[model samples]
Target: MLERWSRGLKGLGNWTAGVMDAFYGALGTPGKYLQDFLNGSWLGHPLHPVLTDVVVGGFTMLIILDLVSLIFGANFRDPSLIILGLTTLAGIATILSGLTDFKDTATGDERNVTTLHGYTNVASILIYAIAFFVRLGGSETTGQILAIIGYLVISVGAFIGGHVVFKYGYMVNHNAFSRGRRAKEFTPIMPAVELAENTPTKAALGPTALVLVRRGDVVYALKETCSHAGGPLSEGQLQGGAIVCPWHASHFRLSDGAVVHGPAHTRQVAYRARIQAGQVEVEGPVG
Candidate 1:
């Protein structure tokens, strides 16, 4: 029964995700503007994830306050009220930030997972909002109940949020896990001439994709994809040994795929090139 229920829940999440994806994708610039904010380009990190922690953390602090009040037999009325007010505003912010992030998400499993997260979050926030109002409207006895209910709702939302990030690897660097443990070990397995002078040939090293280029006699291999958004860097134009992304113009040096322009601050993984027997091979990023 439990397994069945879990499966059902996932199904529901997927269903909702599909709907939300269509909903957001239609929003256009309104969605893009929101996505930028959620991605935290302003803060240099994902704002939705960060803001989520803040909102959830605020509620957790409420639990601590409750405990302290219970133990110290102190009047936490004013303080609890203040905290509850802040929590309301924070919850609002989390919802807005989440909407922004949702806009930029591609239309697929991620969109589905995000939708599930959104529904859970929205439900939990509404619960917390009511709890907040009940606490504000009623006396000490009712305040305690409201606080407990608010905690339960917040806890549920937090668990779903964790599932979204950890299980799905949201906001994580796409290539962070691409590098296997052997990434630092650089040894060329093939000859430089094996790859066409200007054309790049791909070789898999551990898990990373290596794109090779040859200039006269010097051969070099760098990560195959753009560090910015996974554009094929090898397919990009070559300028002074640097590969410029065909999609967004992000450039990386052929010697080492170090960033040469904006938007992509991360370096492309570079590897050593060599020849073994008749097959030319390269040692690229690990993983």
Candidate 2:
């Protein structure tokens, strides 16, 4: 049932793509740096989820405070009001970070799912905003009811957010699990001449698919999947010794697979290739 509803969210994706794409493009270099900081590239994980915990905690506590006040006829309004303010600020921060990440999401089904997750959270935010105003007006009865409703709406948003991670794999490094696990022996997948200079070529070594770009005698290899959203690197363009993912334009340096630009915080798997008997052979990890 949930799957059906989630899938239906794609109907709104086209509109979202048009609106958000412009906002994303406006962010230039400095904006990109700020986006990365908010997304938590420095912390090695997404900041949205971490900040979301605070919002949820604040709301949950507010609900408890309201229930306690109702049950025991006590005055817990001060703490409830304080927590609501804090939670509202935290929620705003989470939205900013989340939208930064979402702007980079590649299109198709994943974008649809992400769009749904985003707007659902927006709905939850609106509810909480209303609850805040009501609480500020000293209408305890109305404020408490709105708070409970807001929490429930946010809970639904939370469920969809979990699906975005566990099911759709957002803000995750698609290549993290197999970085250093490949066998340490050189394996030939194709002739060195087959890969053209400054072009992405696809080849498979054992179970792994790699994108190889040749520059003179040096063939640079990285996992074929983009670290962000698993976009196909072989279909991407090579520029300035870096491969740019076609979908979201995440750039990784071919030499060491370091992220030259992001949405992708983690490095792609790098492999060095040499010509063995006139064929291109890759030997495990690079540097």
Candidate 3:
């Protein structure tokens, strides 16, 4: 009964998210352009967090301002109600940006945590809306009381959001530590000497599949699993210095895992490789 009731309000978020999708969708190319912009192709990270921090941080400042007013009377005089208005607008924008990023995440533990975070934030939004309205009508003692409570709710929502990113690695696809050697410093069962020149060969490293490509003296190694949707990039066509995903045409530079093409903005987790004891060895950079 409680779980169902907890999820009961989720419809509000879904409805709000659907409305945002439609609004952004109607923008057509401009919408896609905004999505790419929010995806942080330029920043090399998801941008929702950046905007979210700004929104939440602004509200935090407002809370402090109110506290100061309550403590040091004259210095923080008449409540303008501007803070609540700005908070409402910024909160709504952050939710929209979060929804866009959330949609791209694949179904997994990360997605579940993200959904929870979103709903928590929605609850905070509701709490804030109520508080904002009360204050907007009249700055009563009860209004101040509600604002304090809303502040606490927002903090909890922020905590949940932090957990989704910091604890669960919501945006990160693969292990990026180990000196980039998890996929590189492997003792390949396939003979290195037998590898075809200027060609990518399939090799097994422990339980993971990898694509080993050589160009004269420099050998490039990356996970055969494409980070976007697990498409087989080993079977993908090689062009210039990148491997193009056959499924989505997402390209990753072999030298480093940087994506050189669209739809896939994340790196492929590159590895440093060498020939040791007549066998191919691969490893990645340490985190």
Candidate 4:
């Protein structure tokens, strides 16, 4: 049903990937910083949804105001125009942030779904922009009709975007489901001798997988799954005091598993590690 329709939109992903790659490639490190900001790494949550709420709310109000002006004969033009202008601005911001998040999406259903979600929103924004201009030209009836049309398109776009998150788990915290089950006591994972200094090594405590790194006598352990996209942290490279996710290059500090850089807004679950006899025992979600 819906899955079939989403699959039909997969071609949009293929068509946009190369263009987005070139655009971001040209920007380099600054682009990554921009992405981090847009992804809300600083705020420890995604920014796209915040802006989306504003756009959706504004448009919803615009529809209400337009309806009042039509049916009740009240003068709501000024307020409606103001809401439209603000919503259009929010829509532009939403596009920027959404694309920034989308840049890191893996190929297949996630990418395909995000592609359709993005372009649909873009179409809605364009329509709203045109409606804004039409309203400014004193054609209230035509502008209202265009705005209603835009709202309908954006509603469809919002549904697809919801599918991307609620269904496919795009931009979801990989560790969300595991938060309550963190080690409550020190659990032996591996032999202390087996963990090499500065090397990312995989170990497990009960059902929880962990990545351990030794720095002299100190052993640092964090959840093996990258919080961003579940990339195995054991396979990632250490940069100074941080572990870099192999999948998206998100850097989580080894000391406390704080995200030093990201597309990942959530912190990796950290653990306390120690050598009890010859075995390395780890516990926590120290972060």
RMSD of each: 6.4, 2.9, 5.6, 1.7
Clashes, model 4: 0
- Winner by TM-score between candidate 3 and candidate 1: 3
Candidate 3, 1-287: lDDT as tens digits: 22233354455545555665677669987776677666665566666778778778767776787777778764432343677667767888787778777665544455555666787777777777777777767764566677677677778777777876676566555434322225433555566687777777877676677788887756788877776656787788898988887865667888887877534657776667776676677776312
List model 2 lDDT by residue over 1-287, tens digit each: 45556577766766666655676568767776776677676566788899989989889999888888889999988888889888988898888888878877666667777777788888888888888888899887888888888888889888888887887678988876766437588888898778787789998987788999888888888989888778899999877979988987878888889877777878888887877788888988765
Give the per-residue lDDT of model 1 (tens digit) for 79-180.
777887887788888887776555444445655666666766787677667767777776666766766776776676677667767776655445666643
Ranking by lDDT: 4, 2, 3, 1
Off by over 4 Å in 3: 1-32, 75-82, 108-110, 126-146, 178-202, 205-208, 212-220, 225-232, 235-251, 260-266, 271-287
| Number of the predicted model whose TM-score against the real structure is largest | 4
| Best candidate according to lDDT | 4
All models: lDDT?
0.64, 0.81, 0.68, 0.88
lDDT of prediction 1: 0.64
Q: In candidate 3, residue 49 scores what lDDT?
A: 77
In candidate 1, stretches whose alpha carbon ends up further than 4 angstroms from where it belongs are 1-34, 42-45, 70-72, 104-110, 180-207, 210-222, 225-287
